[model samples]
Target: MRAAWAIYKRELVGTFCSPLAYAVMVSFLLFNGVVFYFFMDLVASNPSLSGTRGPLQLFFGSTILSVLTLMIFCPATTMRAFAEEWRSRTAETLLTAPVTDLQVVLAKFMGSMTLYAALWVPTLLYALVVRRYGAVDWGALSAAYAGVMLVGGAFVSIGLLASSLAASQVTAFVTSFGVIGGAMFALGLGRYVFTEESQLRFFSYVNLWEHMEHFAVGMMDSRQVVYYGSVVVLALSLTVRALAARREA
Candidate 1:
């Protein structure tokens, strides 16, 4: 446990020491600001957006923007989680250390999740502003944020797994993006090909959109929470297995 924490601290500090983390933070904030402004303007023109005192409209707007930004940023953030260490031969030292492969993988996963959480802080200003000047439902807003974090964690786990499979940073980045992009678009493609009710229901069950919509509407569905948690566990398990196989090889 101590060894894992040491590795976790090392990776967390290393991430901030580079310009990449700063660039991702700045770019994410800028994208959020632009998207929020556009949504606010649209709401101004369409009174329907103002009907609900709840933050669902604003939450949905921000949620979509956040997911898109995360899709682009998370791959870059996780690209070097394992690939860079392997490239520089440092992975050999770590693999041979007095720590299990699962511990190492968990440390890297937590470090990346920490970075993603840090990036989400600045966006809280949007919620504050809406609360002060506009009608907002705090319960729904908080629930939506929770859902976003869980979904982001799941995506980061997937990225970490991709990083383990890659031989280079570029390969890791590309693979991560491909995996995330495929997952995001899979339901739509499945719908196009499978017209039957049973097949469509199965595809919908596998879709993030289907699950996220429930949370975005302020419903705390246990099934959705379990679905996201399952993804996180599956990805992390694969990552640990990959690391063990690499050590053997």
Candidate 2:
């Protein structure tokens, strides 16, 4: 446990010190700022708008915005997890340092999640900013944050596994992106590809966009929670095994 903690602290410090992390954070905030401004401005200028939803809902809705954010930042944050260690020949030193593979994987997963959380931390101000012009739904915004964290657990673990499997950082990033994007797209196809209602319902359970959309409106469905929870566990388990294989090789 001490070893794991040490590794976690080291990785977190490394991430915080990296120019890449700062660049990614700044880029994420800028992109979200533009999106928020556009949505809020639209709401203010258009008086004929329906009372169906708020800017927060649209921000977290089943659009390409969240997806784009994940696509860019998650990979940039995680692509170097184990890949850089292997590249620099430091992985063997750590793997042989009287630490279990599980601990190592957990440390990396957690370190990446810390960086991931920092990426989203700036968006909290969006609520306060919007409060100036409109009433913010605190309940739904809370749910949205929970939903993002839940999905990030799985997404970061998946990226960690990709890093463990790849020998280079670029390859790891591309692999992780492909895995995450392909899984999302494949699950979404269930709505159009399936004829049976029951089958479609199963597919809907794993649809990342729909899951977040549900959270955006303040509904925390148990099925979606279990889906993401399972993904996080499964991905991390595979990552541990992958790292073990690399260590033993």
Number of the predicted model whose TM-score against the real structure is largest: 2
The lDDT of model 1 is 0.78
For all predictions, the C-alpha RMSD in Å is 2.3, 1.4
Error of 2 at 72 (Å): 2.7
Q: Write the per-residue lDDT of candidate 1 for residues 32-68, one digit (tens) a residue.
A: 7888787766776777767753344454533555456
Best by lDDT: 2
Query: Which window of ten consecutive residues has the lowest lDDT sum in model 1?
Result: 53-62
Q: Give residue 178's error in model 2 in angstroms.
A: 0.4
The global C-alpha lDDT for each of the candidates, from Candidate 1 onward, is: 0.78, 0.84
Candidate 1 residue 76 Cα shift, in angstroms, is 2.6
* Model 2, position 201: C-alpha lDDT score: 88
